[model samples]
Target: MSDAAVPDLTELLADSPTNWGKWGPDDEVGSLNYLTAEQVLAGAAQIKKGKVFTLQRLIGDPKGDPVWPGRNPAVREMTLDESHWDEGNNGPAFPGGMHCADDTLTASLQGSTQYDALGHVWYDGKIWNGFDARTTIGGLSKASVAPIAERGDAGRAVLLDIARHRGKEYLEPYETFTHEDLVACAEAQGTPIRPRDILVVRTNHLQLFFEKGDKFYSDFCEAGLVYSPELVSWFQEMEIPNLVTDTIANEVTMDPHNGAALVLHSALMRNLGVAFTEICDLEKLATDCADDGTYSFFYVAAPLKISEATGSPVNPVAIK
Candidate 1:
């Protein structure tokens, strides 16, 4: 294709990590292709005790706390028809019909446990697999989050508890890790990441939020993986496909690769095409894994099929 037709996304692709044509030209699911039937089967095989862990947080408004400026916390309004109300207060939801209630939910999909669609991140004017974001900017149209639901988000999930491995309950905010640190954690935790596995790294990034509440967690910076070209390269080399964390931003706020500025997101989500999951509640799962000496589980997540949308909310489950 001529430069005019293609727009020379080579520099953007080269500068950041990407999976432009890895699956194919028309591919929209990005690295999600890694979760194949075989991969799904492998995930299923890991379930021994049939124990289950819900990895999503209880998503409610932070008691009306201003978590972020302008972004409204999720609000749930429940309604019951007057016909359902009875004599005093315990009346049936419906006078003649069965009692029923309805809820209207206003949510920030990515506010809690969620998988970020490939379309959710873009660089150099294009998305993964060469989709022009300008034309497909209609959220779920181009690289929509809905496809993640089709894929079933089912696979093997491995938790690399960095804090536990380091003999601590949590890493201090702003503590970041390089590729070597990941490898070390893998070794220390005895968790080997296999291809086609979904990786969940727990750095105890959410401890502050739990201990001190939203104000402290929102006010302060947090610790996470050190973002760098080298870290991106490591993910590509391992081909693990997806990563979720108990972190608001999957990586630390500052860039470690000489100031690439969210290059970690670009490399992993945009370039390499790994569907990224963020803000997951991994505290319970981490504790369970550490107690049982098990880190592998069958993981399942299905994002809302909001067609052409940039991203959607999800509640991923881990079956032990």
Candidate 2:
């Protein structure tokens, strides 16, 4: 965000309300610390019909129609005898020609449904809590995405279908919603924003992408929450441990305030120590929430165990 949009750094630091030292030294879990076992039990109580929704998009090659140029697309390969692994040449085959298959996948972890770890963002050569990123974040970092996966993020998930509240299938291109819009959405949905809850916002951009085309949508044209100091304050007030959205970026692709790139990524992940699950498929969730008038459910996200990575692919689930 622009310097004008953000408050004075000195003033913000002086009255910093971040959970830096609250979790103790060498703490990687940030707001996730608030997700107690009791809270998980309480979150599980939201389930009534036991309906499970997979929040991840299935990865696949797009048949030469990549959303973004040069970015890696999902590639699936077979490493076993199915791929011409002759026993005479490669000398590799299953015993008794059982033809057991082993497959390997090459894909971008953050290309589709993903999570941004605490170490994913860096500003001024430092990470969250002012740790030197050069040393603290490497192949093995201080705040890798692995721990969040190991723990299995589980809690109450609340869906804020802003598009539905606006009576639209999706928000328009490049539309920017504000913190006020979120409050209004919650009021309309009759769901209270609770602490340590996972927030899922449906912009329906995924619908547009699938309909209009990925390249058209991936060109940084979509609806999303705007980045502002007030947005940070909202996160602080809600104390949400995890955030997911159908939009490409968590915040608007182009800053409405100062034309900054991924400003919320830095402010939230790098400064406030909040993580994100971006580019999720929330169309069904939004439609269901609007239909049943039930926007709350049990959310669970278990990231792939890729140690020391800045982020990882995640298939977050919502059970209602």
Candidate 3:
């Protein structure tokens, strides 16, 4: 679609609901507030067999890492190594002539498994909690990942294996699922959606990216939850605190109907104050869940406490 034909997010979400001031003006963590002590205990109660799974994808996978277009995978540069401590090299020597390896990594905060600040995306001139978008000028002055890191994320989480439900290794490009589809998938998996439950959805969509490499972005549409007023309302009613997904963007890359991209970022994250955890590696978690028929688990994660960051890399943990 031509840029002229695309509808502005402001127009698309003109009547969308917002949680502004709902948690008071100073609140930055948004719906995460739903993860109360009771929710944490309920999550712990679901742990069985003590199996653990880490949801962060390898940062520098040799085979290549998937990232949103216009972004690059993490690059690690060795700053100090055994090579630097060679006989003639001027490597810094410690008391015992000890040399330790060190490396520096450069990457986009949202380029890997990450948690987006509530103010990460917005329409008009406002962000989550009605903060001015200008607050993000140099770095986020409000609703940055710092607050989320301090509070932490630990609660009952349910995994919805949409690929398994559809009997496919992965959903095809541009495919979409709705809230109703989620309900049905939950029914099939025997995992009912509950209020304040953290949702971990797996489509294994990045399989294509790993397989096709640059070719994966030829058309560049992702299979994910498309936007709708009803879907937004469902999230609000369910009081979802976090949405973790194995996709570049948690929601469809572009709304098929209106051509507006990432409407849910505004509808869910910005407006409803729902936290978004994207680019997760859920293969192990989904496989374990499928084998054991236990899709819900105790989930926890805390992003790096980078000041004023829009997002932060996170390795979320799911325990069963």
Candidate 4:
């Protein structure tokens, strides 16, 4: 179909489900509310081996940090070093003339492994939980990532190595999966996705980005969950608090069925209030899970507390 034939997001998701007002009118974290203390305890119970894996990709990797198109990778510039304290030079004189290195980083908050606030995306002039889009004018005054960072997120997490499940090194561009596919992948991995579990999926798609450089963006659709009404409903029923994936966006770049861009962003995040944790490096976690035949683990992620920001960088950990 031509671009003109595709329905607008409003029309496409007009009748879709939403959790707005389900947690009350002022709720900012959305489905994350499902992560109760009971859930945290349940997650802790899964940590039998004490093996820990960090999921954040390097901020300034020489190989190149993969990010969403139109965003630049992070850059760290050193401001003070040993040279600053050279013979005649002075570096921050203290009681004992102490010297230390200092640096500053500049980059988009969502450039690396991140957690996007509920208000990051929207349609019909409204954001998550019926907040007006104007609330995001200067900065996200409503549904910002600060609330999530303040609260923190921890719970049971299950890894679904979709690439390995299908016997591929990595999923191809525009490759798609559904809730059914997630379930099938989990079953094949000898586990089941419990309700309120943080879903971590691995595709290792960035391997191509590191290998091909700019050519990776020539056709930039990512391999991830595709949106459908049934898929949205499934997420609603499952009470999933967070969706973590090794992809730029947590869903396919464009809906293959309707040609809509990041449909799940609006459907699942905006409507259902599901938190999105994207661009994770799940190689270590997936490798351990595959080797041990244990896919469930205790997952904890605490993003930076930048007020009213759309997202924040995070170094999540998975313990088995």
Scanning candidate 4 in windows of ten residues, the lowest lDDT window is 90-99
RMSD score of candidate 4 (Å): 1.0
Q: Which regions in candidate 1 have their CA more than 4 angstroms from the true location?
A: 1-17, 61-70, 81-97, 217-220
Ranking by lDDT: 4, 3, 2, 1
Candidate 3 local lDDT, residue 315? 95
Model 3's alpha-carbon lDDT is 0.93
lDDT of 2 by residue, 162-202 (tens): 88888887788778887788778988899977777777888
The estimated TM-scores of all candidates read: 0.86, 0.87, 0.98, 0.98
Off by over 4 Å in 2: 1-17, 61-70, 81-93, 136-140, 217-219
Q: Would you list the C-alpha lDDT of every candidate in the order shown?
A: 0.73, 0.74, 0.93, 0.94
Superposed by TM-score, candidate 1 places the C-alpha of residue 140 at a distance from the truth, in angstroms, of 3.9
RMSD score of candidate 1 (Å):
5.5
Runs of candidate 4 with Cα error greater than 4 angstroms are: none
- The digit string of per-residue lDDT tens for model 3 on 28-119 reads 99999999999999999999889999999999999998989999889999999999878898899799878899999999999999999987
Candidate 4 or 3, higher lDDT: 4
Model 1's TM-score against the true structure: 0.86
Residues forming the 10-long window of minimal summed lDDT in candidate 2: 61-70
Model 3 misplacement above 4 A? none
By lDDT, who's the top model here?
Answer: 4
RMSD of each: 5.5, 3.4, 0.8, 1.0
